[model samples]
Target: MTTIQPTHRRGATRLTDAGRDIATMLWRDTIRTARQPEMLVFAVVMGVFFLVLFNYVFGGAIGAGAEVDYLQFLVPGVFVITALQGAQQSSMGLATDLAEGVTDRFRSLPMSQVAVIAGRTLADAFRNLVGLALVALLALVMGYRFDSATGAVAAILLATAVGFGFSWLGAAIAAKVRQPDMVGMLSMFWLFPLMLASTAFAPADSMPGWLQPFATYQPISVASDAVRGLCDGALDTGDLVLAVGWTVGLLAVFAPLSIRIYTETD
Candidate 1:
């Protein structure tokens, strides 16, 4: 019997392979989202609602000394919150696929293993853009505007990367847990505490004496502050480094873990 030859992607550089796989997965996600636009709509509505509610509810309380036009402060915080919610969708999708036996079908195919993770994540990145655009448009209609388009785009891209990174982490969790309900519940529970405990709503100095320290240094706070700087053209190397660290670091840890678990999982 002739020996079987291992499949080789001839001269397909890593970047090319990654780009090809990402495009394929992204198309799949876009089609899927188009078929079920409710998810996208819901995310947009939620982002808009929170932005309005928070801007009015706590705007005066925070005081102009704290932040002029609390909507500006609210915008950055809501951006991070929206990114977190976007990650939950990523987990939900993975959990749905696993529960419905779709992932098994992917496993039986000749597609690259990493493609599934990367594609799903790239798709979530697009979802993030749609959500962000909706929120930004709504904010504009409500009298909110960014000082610089280039900076806004940079911050949004960074936000999308963060969303994608967390989505991968969520995928890893969903794959290992194998339960959609628990996946959503656990993800939301953690996400909620993480957002509330930080400086999302108010400055860390405004927080209680007991909570100030943690809130000041929380990763989410750092991220929100960085995004604020980006929108305001106060970009600094430190913030960029922190933003990149959070996105790349999360992906570095979770992306490989997700692939490994998916490969070994039943």
Candidate 2:
């Protein structure tokens, strides 16, 4: 058997080959999903369903003023929720690959081990971008509009980054646990309650008498609020700061945790 070797030149590690390998892994995963397509369809369907249901369901009762249309206000919420919900694919894919020994095969190859998770995370980020664009188009047809193009672009990019960060988190958990069902449940447990218990579906003030503070401070809330400002044409620094804070904090904690788990696992 011929060994696959990592090339080196003048004592400096040759990283171009590793980068190409990582890109190949990312492209292969994306192509696999393209061939199947059901998972992506499911995610898009769920996003559309929630956008229709909530924009009309609670829009009448919540009444946060019409400076921005209710659908517009709700769009940001949907975007955040959709990003969080879409994170499930990462964990599910990871768990399935781990169970089938695909990861082991990758480990035996002469490639950067971190590429396994990073490539998957990158592929999932692209998938979520498609989801976001589809959801936005649906919202537009439903009479939603944002006031600032720059802010809209910024918010979408930030939400996508948030999706990528959570993808790593989910992939890490799936790798360590090696169970698809458990990873699914654990991911939903964190996501669902975060959606309902926070200001995602309603204003922070409209939250229960006792849960207001928690809902206000939740990362999802911070993200939604920031996006809300952008949609409403009022870009406040506080919301932007809080949004970055949550993204950075989550990436800081979960990224390292996932890497450690990936290396130590199996």
TM-score of each: 0.90, 0.89
Worst 10 residues of 1 by lDDT: 6-15
- Superposed Cα deviation of residue 51, candidate 1 (Å): 0.4
lDDT of residue 22 for candidate 1? 69
C-alpha lDDT of candidate 2 relative to the true structure: 0.78
Task: Find the 10 residues in a row with the least total lDDT in model 2.
Answer: 5-14
Cα lDDT, model 1, residue 11:
61
lDDT string for model 1 (28-67, tens) is 8789878988888888877877898888876777755653
Question: What lDDT does model 1 reach?
Answer: 0.79
Error of 2 at 140 (Å): 0.7
- On lDDT, the leading prediction is 1
Relative to the true structure, candidate 2 reaches a TM of 0.89
Residue 251 miss distance in model 2 (angstroms): 1.8
